[model samples]
Target: MNGVVQNDAWREEYNTLKEQYTELKRLKEEVKKLEKSCFTSSQKQLKKLSTIKKQLSKGTSGQEVTAKEVTEVEESLKKIRETLPQPNNLFLRSIVGSINVTIPNSEDKLVYKERYENFKRNVTIVICILSLLAIWIRGYTRLPEFILQFVSAWFYLALTVREQILIRNGSKISTWWVLHHYFSIAIAGIFLIWPEGECYRNFQMQFLYFTLTISGIMYLQFIYQKGQLYKLRTLGRAHQMDFVQDAGMRSRSMGDLYFLVPFLLYTYVFQLANSYRLYNMYYMQECQTLWQVPILGVLFFIVALGNTWTLALVLVRKYNS
Candidate 1:
């Protein structure tokens, strides 16, 4: 009797293990089927998205659509997007109906969208505060120049955060932005070490250094942006995109001649200023304040004239268009 009872217990244990194996196999098959279905659905959605993009591109411009038509399209696309199996598909959804989707082709679209909207709201608040501070700095408060520098540094730091977001969202880095980033850091460093209660003469020298540094950095940035534009045009041609080279191909006129001449003058002046400063530093000699004064004056005049001409040209083009 004891032997028979032991046999029955062993048999029951084997049966329980067999049942668990069967259930495991069933679950594995179900998962595979679900995965296959998901892939099929995703492919279908992608095709639909491509179709919509093509249709929108064919239209005159997204803005040309009637308000009612836009509303209808948006609602229909929103419904289809809502039915998608995964939230990662939101990037496709955004392109279907929106005209100016800035955060394109990002994998984490939802997270990025939320962050971008919050950033815009914060910028608006900061701008208002800065406006108030500017008024205060000019009127009620007689803050030291260093204090003004500190405030400017902080304001630029806030702007940097926004730029970082743009970089993460795959926007091409502009030369201007790259220089601005480094220049902001350099200015912040200068302010941190700047002596307290310095004489007005000393302050003026420091301010001049700051101005020269900023001008040099910005000039480099302009050159970089121009180069990037050229490269982009070349790329567009290689890709056979319907790119209009109207603006790129137009030969700059005599009105614009003054613009290029000044940039060349400024570059020369910047190099001269750097050389003079280095010479004075190395020789332990007092540098004359007027050494680069003439060059600076010329730069100022050229910048003003170039800016006026550029503005007039832009206005005329816009009005004509």
Candidate 2:
């Protein structure tokens, strides 16, 4: 009898659990339906708000849609967007072929962004160390320089992808920084493929030394700007997604200007100097026949101009704000 009773008890417990599981499954479906409904509703609202904005921009007035109403609706739309998930930007869509990069969980998003920043810093350090070794070994057109070029190309490619991910996750990284990496990739590729000859030998040390110098500058920027970002975040003055840039590309206080601005200007000047040297080398009998010289010179000139213009705009905005 006791064995029969135990069997009956187990059967009853199993039935209870089965019922609970069925209810949980039903609830999950219901939740999914509600989420879809909300998304559809938000889409409709966004369309309506967009129409209202267009009307307002055209100086059209309506009883139901005042300027204040449109503004409020726009704000509501922005908040709704914050709650909803988004996919990668158009640039990433074109290149990386569009997978959602949004991190839904707040804690997970923060952790991922922190990891991204650390990855950049670690790569910078690795490149700096390798550059130093290359310089010390004095292998301008040999294995060391080749290795550095390969590593740099890979680093820039990876960095560009990660920055895209970060941008998708709500980081306010500038377009110029994104383009800068693309340019760097191209330059690195040119360096990787350029034939080793008198022209290569002439420009090799200058290029390596410039890489080391910039790496050092970037390291210092990372150290100082990381602290600045943390402080700004703590004070609720900056977004959590913000990361350090070698040029302090974001609008910030003038305090770091005294320390970082000179270095940034020096970097631009160095690029220009490289460009001029390349220009001069391209005319020399030894380098004149090389196709890489003029191309590299033009690229360096453009990069320098872009960097200076971007920094100037950033500083101007900072001052105005």
Candidate 3:
């Protein structure tokens, strides 16, 4: 009778364990059902996902409509973007639409600041790297010079062309940008006709040194500009999506002038050194290479003045404000 009682107790324990296991499995199934109903567990993300889905279903293109899928998607995205509250930015349209869709342009800045930023970043990197490589490599023909000229021409064309994508997209940078790069093209052009001599060889290394400075400054500028853009983006003060400054933007720009002062001084000092060297090499030393000596001197002076004037103007603007 005692053995029988022990067997019955063991069976009851087994039954309790089985029931508990089944209950756990049932709870898991219920959870899966809830997840299936919601599609996403996070409630915060649901609104955005639902908005997109609704837009696709009932947007510019009718839901059952099979044609113009690209246009439909572009239109839906534009409409959704329009729903967001944005500042009064009428510089350029930042919203780049699909190739097929006619962009619904407002007097807004470029299609997207992010895209323009990426574009400029990529271009700056490629041109600088290739230009540096071209200058470093020794060649019999004007191939290296040609490469440098090609880079200059490409940038100049991109910057100077009327209705270029960047300008149209409302890139409101300084006027000195136009002047500096334009002069760069002219300088590179002079290199094409330059003859090989001791002066030529010496000038090449120095010019490379100067190019290194230019590249370094540009890299630093790119980083600083991106940082500024990030701050504006966080504050939502950016023009459309581009870096359009307002009165509020000056808070950081003014505070940072101290940092820029050093960069400006370095630039002027380097250009002055270059000017002195050119003057000594050409006039004092009696070098007859017009392309490398006198003309270069004149161009270097112009660059220094142009660059200095620009920085001075920026400083005055910041201080006066």
The per-prediction CA RMSD against the true structure, in angstroms, equals: 17.5, 4.8, 16.9
Better of 1 and 2 by TM-score: 2
The runs of at least 3 residues in candidate 1 whose Cα sits more than 4 Å from the true structure, single-residue gaps closed, are 1-142, 174-180, 197-200, 203-275, 278-321
Residue 66 local lDDT, model 2? 81
Off by over 4 Å in 3: 1-116, 131-145, 162-165, 241-253, 284-286
Instruction: Compose the digit string of candidate 1's lDDT tens values, residues 1-321.
Output: 455454787899999999999999999889658755765765676675556556666764444555466557655654443333333223334434333234434455446544544553454344344434443454344344445456556656655554444443443344444444445554544544444332223334434444444444443444443444456556663211111112222223434334444554454455445435434433333323333333333333344354445445644665455
Q: Which residue pairs clash within candidate 2?
A: none
lDDT of each: 0.46, 0.81, 0.59
lDDT for model 1, on a 0 to 1 scale?
0.46
Model 2 TM-score relative to the real fold? 0.82
| Candidate 3, lDDT over the whole model | 0.59
Which run of 10 residues does model 3 get worst, by summed lDDT? Answer: 95-104
Between candidates 2 and 3, name the one with more favorable lDDT. Answer: 2
Full candidate order by lDDT, most accurate first:
2, 3, 1
